[model samples]
Target: MSKVVFITGASSGIGKSIGLYLHGKNYKVYGTSRNPSKVNVPFSMVALDVTQKESIKRAIGEVIGIEGKIDVLINNAGKGITGPIEDTPTEEMKFNFDTNFFGVIDVIKEVLPSMRLEKSGLIINTTSIAGYMGLPFRGVYSASKGALELVTEALSMEVKSFGVRVVNVAPGDFATNIAAGRYHTPVFENSAYKEKYAENLALMDSHVSSGEDPMMMAKAIYEIIKSKSPKIHYKVGGFMEKFSIILKRVLPDKIYEKLLMNHYKL
Candidate 1:
């Protein structure tokens, strides 16, 4: 029997690419969008809003009803927030965490029961290289992905004995529709960070616009699903972005901080 795969945020970008790639490989894929009627994917589409528990429950139930079991669950529904730490409102930070962190948790909770009952499953989370080191203007976005990465690490150990595996796929900048979906906090005309915010926001967008194809990430995900024992974390992106992970681990705190600042032109 073909393994069943479920993915969130599949209306476009990385999530949509992965759903199509896996379905073409005969994985029996189901993808979700906040508005199912708007999704134009070939695979089955489910209406899911991960931040809401009831929506998550309904989506998971629908999948289970048709597939009997979910062999792989991809938590890819997330958006980015940009602003200086002090200028970012509390509500905005909460909104970032709602979709990036808590939403992932809610969906995982709903699917784990079924995965645990079957004694086998794979949970692949989409994290980012920014999660490793807090970015200057995008601190809130960084914090959310960083939190998810830690949860993925801890969850892997907690469910290892149940024949379940959890892993985080941290990609660097990718050419996707993330820019269109990104949320920017309100900035006052006289705010201290006004100038820097404008500069950094453009820089971030440019980097993402010139990033590698989203299909690269889809290929990496496909490989992970085929593996019998995948690593707890996989970094997928350009050479520098992948190497930065190593640099952060081996370099001293102060030195690494300097390098990070220099790289972002802070």
Candidate 2:
């Protein structure tokens, strides 16, 4: 039997691409959106709001009911939040963590019981290259995804003996509809960061508009599933985007900060 794969936030964007690609490859793919009925895709679509625990439980139960077990769990559901740290609302940051961090944990916990019982499973987290660094105007998003990356590392060790594997796949920007959905603190007129924040926001949108294809992520994910011993972390993106993570590791704190500031034209 094909492995059962469950993905969150699959209505569109990277999540959609991963789901479609896996379905085409004969994996039993079940993806979730807040309202799955609205989206037409080859894979099964279920309703799941990551921000709601009950929704997560119901979605996982529905999949387990049909498949008996979820061989792979992909935590791709996430929210994007961007603005200067001072200008962005604290509540919005917490909300982002709820979706990008807490929600992911909830989904993983719901699936672990079945996975542990089966003594075999894979959990792949869809984090961001941005998660590796604090990018301008996107600090909250970075924090949320970065936290997930750390959790993936810790969870991998905890579940190793159970025969369940965990990994993080951090993707660079991809052409997607994320910009339209993310919370953007209004460009307050009198605020100190008015001009720069407005400029950076547009730049951010353009980067996504011109980003790499989401199918690349799908293909990378497919390869991981086929591997017998996949690494703890897999990065899928352009050379420079992937290299930036390396640079962060090697460079001094101030120098790295300077490089990012220059890139953002701050």
Candidate 3:
């Protein structure tokens, strides 16, 4: 029998690509989105809002009703928040974490019972490269992803005995709508760091617009799923991102910051 997969945030970008890629591979994929009507894929699409417990639970129930078992759960739906921490409001931070961090938690919680009962499953949480290396103007988004990294690590250990595996996929600047469509926070009328905010926005826009293709990430996900034993973390992107990870490990803190500031002209 073909493996069954559940993927969230399938309306567009990486989530959508994963759904299409897996479906082509003959997997029974149930794609979830806030608006299932907007998803163009032919796979079974379900409406889900990861931030809401009831929505996630209902979506999982719908999938289970048909598939009977979930072989893989891909937590790929997430948004981006860009701005200085000092300039960002407390409420905005809460909202960002609510979607990016707690939202994933809710999805995992709802699906755990099924996986536990079956005693076999794979959970792939879409973390960001920001989770590994902190970037300017993305403090809150980084915080959320960093939280996910920790959670995935703990989850890997906790679920190991159950024959369930948890892994984190951290992709660097990819050609996706995340930096554009996924970035939004209530702006204040007047702020001291308005100029800095503008600069950072322009910087982020440039990087993502000119980044690696999202399909590359889809291929990475496929490889991990095909692997017999996947690692706790998988980094996908261009050669520069791989080198950046190494540089961040070996270079001095000041040097790394200097390199980033210079590269982005910040």
Best by lDDT: 2
TM-score of 1: 0.98
Task: Sum up the clashes in candidate 1.
Answer: 0
TM-score winner:
2
Worst 10 residues of 2 by lDDT: 34-43
True lDDT of residue 116, candidate 3: 92
Residue-pair clashes per candidate, as listed? 0, 0, 0
lDDT of each: 0.93, 0.95, 0.88
Could you arrange the candidates by TM-score from highest to lowest?
2, 1, 3
Among all windows of 10 consecutive residues in model 1, the one with the lowest summed lDDT is: 179-188
Rank order (by lDDT, best first): 2, 1, 3
Q: Count backbone clashes in candidate 3.
A: 0
Models 1 onward score TM values of: 0.98, 0.99, 0.95
- Candidate 1 — which residues are off by over 4 angstroms? none
Q: In model 2, what is the error at residue 220, expressed in angstroms?
A: 0.2
lDDT per residue, candidate 1, 142-182, as tens digits?
99999999999999999999999999999999999898898
